[model samples]
Target: MATNYNDYFKKNNDNDNNSNNTGGGFTPPELPNFLNKPIVWIIAILIVLAIFAKPFVVINQGEVGILSTTGKFDPEPLNAGMHFYIPIFQKVYVVDTKIHIINYKRIAEAGSMNDTRGGIKLYPSINVLDSRGLPVTIELTFGYRLNPKTAAQTIATYGFNWEDKIINPLVRDVVRNIVGRFPAEDLPIKRNQIATLINSKMQEKLDKLQSNPVILESVQLRQIILPNKIKDQILSVQVAKQQAQRVQYEVLKAKQEAQKRAALAQGMAEAKKIQAQGTAQAITIQANAQAKANKLISESLTPKLLQLKQIEVQGKFNEALKVNKNAQIFLTPGGVVPNLWINAKDKQKASVSK
Candidate 1:
């Protein structure tokens, strides 16, 4: 910290002198005359200051920086990093490149804005005229991102509010145009078709842009708000359809039950017919067997056999007359018929001998 400038300079001078005389020791090179000038030093100091305390912008991830020289924006965008620019003549605009959402819903359905970021925006549900000129409300959500490659050009052409001028207008116009092609009542039923048309049309329009400024991610149709009368009519139609289906099902069930009962009755009738046929057959068979047995008995009978039977009957009568002394005995003409005797004691009773 002590003063040593004089001795230090003198020692360097002596070494230079010795080098000049002996040509043995190394000599320090002299500074250029221009570098020693005050203006040159000032310029150097200013350059250093510019490097250390420069005007700068940070291009974060999911962001791109657009450099502007004077008023014209550079076509090529700077990637994520610290970017320096001249204070007055140059500037860099940091634009987000991440996916962003635009929600079109009823005003009553919009949530608190405090939770939203620069990337998320909310608008009132789109109102469009149907083919019948009836007003219909369309609620939807779509995602998009700034094309980093063309972000600068997009910002230059559409300004920083490009989403409003480009996306919002495009979406609303597409919805109105497409929705206007159908009746209000049809919108709910054709919601998927409407949504598909909207997304494709928007993408087509975006692709038609010079730089393809926005990349559309996806589009979702959240709700189709129809008039109360249309809703009531749809509900009534659905209810009527349900009632008709119920009636048809009941009719089918009744037909099945009737068919089952008819099948059962037919089965019972066939069973009774079979039973009657069996009984008739059994009676005929029995009568035939009994007639055959009687025929055999009649074929075996002879005249002598008849006489023998008559004599036996007479012998029995004689035995009976011995028991009842006054009994009256009578013989039939042939023994094929048995003889009869009347008891004298009981006039009403008679005895028969076989």
Candidate 2:
């Protein structure tokens, strides 16, 4: 390292001079006169600087940089910041370690970067077959993050196109595999189940990635679309079921009304019978009381009582004559006649005259 440049240059110059003298077919390549100027050294320096600049990479925040030495990736990854490596012999590939969203939509979704709204809005979605072999389209969105621990492996496996190469393929395959377990009609209703299965299977699939694999955060099935014919069939079946239910309900209601009417009629008949029996008993009691009273009164009376009552009535008749002698009376049922009564002292003579 000490002053060996002089000896080294002297030896190289001697070899060149001897080669020229010996006259080999090989000749010293001549340099352009421009390259010999001062500007040429500056250009050479710039070229060296440019070559040296390749190793100094600026890894932004939320990024993980992997180094490839001589076309092979280094096991150790570089975090966000500036890093240096051997120029022309190595390269650094930056991986965004931030969480990434993988969205697929059919209906307009809120928080959509596309800003699309209702009406004829179609989006790219995953179409797969259900258990019935019917095609179903799923609109989904999920989140993921590159595992920093596996950053080197990720770069080696998918490089910069992990979404297309790894994430999407696994997602599509997992979704189809999971969704295929349900009937086409059930897919729309079983959206949550489908999403759960997809997430689980996707996580399982991601765990199998070359190195540390991607961390699958979540999976969601936003919308499910079935064939129009299937939807119509389902609707028709539902309508028919509703109609049948209504008919059954009406029949049940009619039966209940009939039962109620029968009960009412029976009750009315029973009440009438009770009322008639009570009335008959009351009338019999009244007739018996009247007959007993008449018997008692008859037993208490005698002939003497009868004679005295006649004498009293005669006295009343005499008083009545004194007041109104012209008053007429019926002597018998066959004729109207006048009173023939005289003084009670002349009873025998009055009798002879009548």
- lDDT against the true structure, each candidate: 0.84, 0.74
lDDT of 1 at 27: 78
Error of 2 at 116 (Å): 16
lDDT of 2: 0.74
Lowest lDDT 10-mer window, candidate 2? 330-339
lDDT (Cα, tens digit) per residue for candidate 2, span 53-145:
865888888888888888888877798788988777887888778777767765344454444332122235888888878888888887788
On lDDT, the leading prediction is 1
lDDT of 1 by residue, 1-354 (tens): 654545666688887998889868777876565754567768999899888867888888998988999988989899988887887799888888999998888767567532355777888889988898877888899899999999988998889988878988899989899899999877888889988999999999999988899999999999988888888988998899999999999999999999999999999999999999999999999989989998987887677777787777777777877887998766655545576778778987755544
TM-score of each: 0.61, 0.51
In model 2, the runs with Cα more than 4 Å from the true position are 1-55, 105-123, 240-354
Model 1: clashing residue pairs?
none
